[model samples]
Target: MSPRKVSLMSRILVYVLVAIAALYLLLCVALFVFQRALIYFPQPSAYATPDNVLTLPVADANLQVSVRPHDGPKALLYFGGNAEDVSQNLPSFSAAFPDQAIYLLHYRGFGGSSGSPSEEAIARDALDLFDRVYAEHPQVAVVGRSLGTGVAIRLASQRPAARLILVTPYNSLLELGIRQYPMFPVKWLLKDTFDSAKYAAHISVPTLLIAAEHDEVIPRSSTVRLYGQFIQGVASMKVIAGVGHNSISESPEYLKLIGAGL
Candidate 1:
């Protein structure tokens, strides 16, 4: 090839590389700007009942906690998915575990809760809720699903939850983020990395991890890894067949296993 032709090709390659780099940079910037939107999917309360709603004041925010009050020391605290309306689960939970009082938390900015959602804020609020529940009810079990699994695991590790149940749980949001955005430095960029693996080692309570056999959102390996992080014999796993991540609750076995955990 002629020297002029070689020079032209080199210039073209430089321009293409610069364009690619610019696009990647733009993508990283957008990911940084709208990262929270990608993480927390806050929704309005689906089953709003003034009588059942308990207002718990967190710092600079009033969190809506749905309570099915029962006159007993047995209580169950539930933390739900990112976009879940936990109030909707009251009837089912009440029926499943009638003996225990139920309290379902609506994460910050979710349902009627004030302020925005973050890992730090949710963890703090959950710990506070657990403490309050523990005060009234000495025997308390905790349940979490999806995003709430991270919150529940953290609380279980920090507090004395009699039992812990995680439904369709992931190892960590950081792992999920890294998998979803392989080209980006997700661990560094992610502000709310819900790393449940960090807390799993500290959880010594009887723990049950329920996995969806057909889970499309969180990889089965992630759930297995999380289960392994727990001290052997402290955590047990159940994989319900013919269910995906969202539809796992629909399975009859789901409630049965949850009840068994308690």
Candidate 2:
């Protein structure tokens, strides 16, 4: 090839490389800006009525707590998944634990709650709700499912929870994000890295880690890793047979395992 032809080929290669670099930068920016949208999917309350709803006034938001009020010192405080309408569990919880009072929190922007949802904001709300509930019901059991497992574990670490239950929980959201989008730098870009393992070591109460046998969302390895974080005698794990992540609660053993923990 002539010298002029070699020079032209080099110029074309440079241009292609620049275009690829520019597109990669744009993709990273989009992921950073809209990351929260990928995490939280707020839903309306299915049972939002005067009889079932309790309004919790916080500094920046008014959170909704779906309640099954019972007159007892024994109470259950529940935190649900990102996209879950927690009110849907009221009937089942009421039937299973008839003697205990139930309080299922609706994270901000979910189930008629005001303001946006974030890790910091939800943490504050969870602390406030636990304090309020503990004032009335001294023996409070904390139960969290999926996204809420992160919330529940952290709360149990900081508060004096009588019992702790985590359902379909992951070791860390950051790790899951990295697995889902390996091309990106998830460790640096993730703002709400729910590292439940970090909080798991701090937990001292009787705890239950529930896993679905065929969970497609959270890997069994992640659940097992979290279980190992707890002290030798602090936590116990149970896997419900013939269930997926979403369908685990439908199993009869689900409530039984939770009740057994309490």
Q: Pick the candidate with the highest TM-score.
A: 2
Off by over 4 Å in 2: none
List the pairs of residues colliding in candidate 1. Answer: none
Q: Write the per-residue lDDT of candidate 2 for residues 1-262, one digit (tens) a residue.
A: 9999999999999999999999998999999989999999999999999999999999999999999998879999999998999999999999999988999999999999999999989999999999999999999999999999999999999999999999999999998999999999999899999999999989999999999999999999999999999999999999999999999999999999988888
Stretch of 10 with least lDDT, candidate 1: 43-52
Point out where model 1 deviates above 4 Å.
Answer: 1-5
Candidate 2's error at 161, in angstroms?
0.2
TM-scores of the models, in the order given: 0.96, 0.98
lDDT of 2: 0.95
After best superposition, candidate 1 residue 183: deviation in angstroms? Answer: 2.2
Error of 2 at 245 (Å): 0.8
